[model samples]
Target: MTTVALLDYGSGNLRSAERAIAATGAETIVTADPGTVLAADGLVVPGVGAFAACMEGLRAVNGPRLIGSRLAGGRPVLGICVGMQVLFDRGVEFAEGIHAPEAADEAGEAAPQAVGAPGCGEWPGTVERLDAAVLPHMGWNTVEVALGSRLFAGLDPNERYYFVHSYAARRWELTDTGRIAAPLVHWAEHDGCRFVAAVENGPLWATQFHPEKSGAAGAALLRNWVATLD
Candidate 1:
């Protein structure tokens, strides 16, 4: 049986994610143990809340290192929502406050701390707040999925997925050198701003939308991911 670890780092809709993955006929365990996470056939990192807080929780259990180890060994790792954001180099939301120095020098001058939430750096880019008229682009939306994408295989190009987010990777920064396959990026528009919706880069897959809440289409995507585990 293919076992998937639903990482529990004090964030995300844990039960819902676990149920969704389990519905794909895979053995799903919602755990925070590094051993269990590392040993699983696949790892799912699901997060909901502020990026900084989620990173703190993830670091608490050394989730980033676990993910790195898995990816280094060619193991699959899936991330959703803020889970995806933390995979990048950094996130700009609440950046100023999170990285602010706790104390000032004797001259009473506060030193400028580094900006943005430090991420796992699996992908290069920063998750910044969307420049949309309406905050939190919440609803069902379709993505411009790339062709021949294993993650979007068998799914219609017009299929809509559930989304609820205020921040996203507005621009993709990875370039395709002759050395590696270029990352497949999908874009979606909300209030006239186009942002990255899904990404497929080798063993790492992520979506800004909530697949577990996306109904039938979502289930199909989850099943597709499980099918790849074989």
Candidate 2:
């Protein structure tokens, strides 16, 4: 049987994610062991809460090295929620709100207000607060699936997935260098501002939404990804 390793770096709903993945018929193990993480047929990196904090936890367990090692060898990896945010270059979490700026310093210069946390840098782009009237873009939402997206394959265009997030990658910055294929980027909107909802780039796949809590649509998406595992 195929085995999937869920990286336990003191973040995410491990049991829920494990159960969701296991439902796809793959043997899922929640482990922080380096050996198990690298040797597994597929790896899931799930995260919640603040971006910088998640990075700190991931670093404690040498997650960056393990994930890099697996991807370097063309092994598959999946990320969810803040897990997906950490995959980007940076995550800018504001202290007050998106529109609120900090008071100027004594020198009459604007003080740095936002907490700009660095991410894993697997992809180019910054995960920042969504420009919307509402606080968090909670509840169900639909995504515009990318062409040739193995991740969103067989999913209906109108299929809605559960999303509970405030910050997200507002744009896809990575361009085709011709040397390698461009990544398949999926977009979703919240109050007119669109953001990256999912990404499928070679061996690495991720989603900003929680698949484990997304009902039937989420389950089907998990199944599609699990089907690609060896």
Candidate 3:
């Protein structure tokens, strides 16, 4: 049986992700141990709330290194929601340094705040807030799947997945390293702003939507992800 590790970095919808992956007939373990995380056949990173807080939690358990190590070895790692956002170079939501320093103190010294918090950097680009009238783009939305995508395999093109997010990658950052194939990108639009909804790059896969909360369509997506493990 494929043993999957649902990384517990003090964030994420842990139980839901666990039940979802388990339904696919894979043994799923929710843990924060570095050893267990590294030894798992597949790793699932799920997160909720603020990006900076999530990165702090992940660092508490050395999650960034764990994920980096896994990806370096070409192992499989799946990120959901904020978990996916943290895979980028940086998140612009609560970014620091851009703001001017506070007023000088009595001694003519200014208190400079820290710079922007870094992400896992597994992928290029920054996760920015969506430029939409409505705050969170919550509810069902359809994604335009890339041709020959394994993540969306066996699923209809017009299938709708559950989404509840306020920030996403505006555009994919594609670099020609001349070493690997280009990543397959999926796009979804809300309130006239289109954003990257999903990405499949080699052993790394991520979705902006919550497959666990997506019902039947989500089940199919999870099954497709599990199918790739074989």
Candidate 4:
């Protein structure tokens, strides 16, 4: 059996995530120990909170420095939601209202001019304001899956998954050449501007949607994730 370590960072939707993975018949362990993480067959860094809190929690639980080494060992590592955002060097969040949109616009413009932009941090890309039909993008929405990722296994392109978040990842357009993979984007309209809804890179997959809220299709997706364990 592939051992899965659900890194407990004090707060998150752990019970639901645990139940989803368990449906796949894999063993799950909630842990705050670094040794437990390093010994696992695969690691899942799950989170639901501010970016700074998530980062601090990871450090607190696993000494802050173990993440890179544990993840880089080639063992499968999955970061769900905020956990996924942390996989990048940094992320854009709404902790500060001042960061709502104008900040994103300024960051967008400064990317080319500055080697490193302020609000966007060191993400190797820039952030943009999402123009979705509704803001905070709650309820159910379907993702246009990127075929071959295995993350979307057993799900259709039009299938709607549950979401309850205001911020989404939109850091690709401003990226320098070779900095971004063939990015995957989902959409909605807010402020008459369209923006990225999700992103995936090699060995890393994340989404703002909570599978636990998505019903059977979501459960199957979690199972598919478990099945991929070597």
Candidate 5:
């Protein structure tokens, strides 16, 4: 059986994410312990609230190394919402609650604030702030997955799912399927902006939308995530 590690970083939407993963019948371990994470077959990092605060939690629990190890080991990892963005190099722009123009005033140019923490990343992907669409990108929107990914398993062509995010990924390429230890589907575009809806770099599958809140199509997506372990 697939051992799915449902990470609980104190303030998180633990129960719902757990239910989504559990529906796949994988063993779900929701805890603050890093050791439990290291031992798991698959890892799910689910988060809500501010980005900086979550990073603090990930650091306090020694999640940096724990998660990095899993990613390096090619263990399946799933990141949702803020969890998805966390995998990037850094999100100083959003974390500071400032826009690019404002950030430019702070620095010479629009640059991400580098965190001194060990586990925190520099936010490898890009961040797209769309003006035409509403902020948070709330409600249902169609997700045009890159192509051929476990995250989009059993999904019909041109499927739609719910979303809620003000910022979207500015850049992220689809992982080379062959070398993907935690493969990802990257930077799906909607309303002229590309966003990282789901990413699989090998064993990891991360999405910005809440699969648990996505209903039937989401349930099928979760099942697909489970199938990858087989």
Candidate 6:
């Protein structure tokens, strides 16, 4: 049986994600063991809560090193929700009255300044607050799937996924490095603001939404990813 390490770095929707992936018939292990994480057939990094806090926890168990080593060997790895966000270069958390530059009003006035936390830098972009009037773009939303997306294979284009996040990577800045193939990026919009919903780049695949909580469609997505482990 295929084995997947569900990284338990003190964050993420652990039990739910574990049950979801295990439902795909893959043996899932929720662990903080670096050796197990790197040795598994696949690794699932599921995370929730603030960006900085998640990073702190991830670093605790050498999460970044393990992820980097896996990708270096072309081993498959998956990231969910905040797990996906930390894959980027940085994440800026805005204060109560502040907003991201992308969230600037029509008048072009600047929002209050905010500090950023360093991310895993797997991709070149910053996770920032969405411009939507609503604080969290909670609930269900459909994504604009990228052509040839294995993650969305066998799923309807209009299928909605469960999203419960206010911050997202609003841009895809990783350009072709010539040696590396370009990443396929899926997008979603909320109140006129667009953000990256998912990305499939070689050995690394990620979703900004919680697939474990997304019902049948989510199962299909996880199955699709699990299929790629071979």
Better of 3 and 4 by lDDT: 3
- Candidate 2, residues 1-230, lDDT tens digits: the string is 99999999999688999999999999999999999999999999999888888999999999988998999898999999999999999999875554434233554655557899888888888999888867589999999998888787788999999998899999899886232768888999999889999998988999999999999989999999989996
The local distance difference test score of each candidate is 0.89, 0.89, 0.87, 0.60, 0.71, 0.91
> lDDT of candidate 4?
0.60
> TM-scores of the models, in the given order?
0.89, 0.92, 0.89, 0.75, 0.81, 0.92
lDDT of 4 by residue, 133-164 (tens): 45565687656565555777667778887766
- Among residues 3 or more apart in sequence or in different chains, the pairs in candidate 3 whose N, CA or C atoms overlap within 3 Å are none
Positional deviation of 23 in candidate 5, in angstroms?
1.2
Lowest summed lDDT over 10 consecutive residues: which window, candidate 6?
96-105
The number of the candidate with the highest lDDT is 6
Q: Count the backbone clashes (under 3 Å) in each candidate.
A: 0, 0, 0, 7, 30, 0
Write candidate 3's Cα lDDT for 19-106 as tens digits: 9999999999999998999988899999988788999999999999999999888889999999999999998663332222333244
**Residue 106 CA error for candidate 2 (Å)?**
22
lDDT of 5 by residue, 26-81 (tens): 88889867788878888888877666677788888877677878877777778888
Q: Over all chains combined, what TM-score does candidate 6 have?
A: 0.92
Looking at model 4, residue 193 earns an lDDT score of 49
Give the alpha carbon lDDT tens digit for every residue of 1-230 in model 6. 89999998999579999999999999999998888898999999999998989999999999999999999999999999999999999999865443555666555876656878999998888998887887688899999998989999999999999999999999999887343667899999988999999999999999999999999999999999999987
Error of 1 at 207 (Å): 0.4
Q: After superposition, how far is residue 53 of candidate 4 from its true place, in Å?
A: 1.9
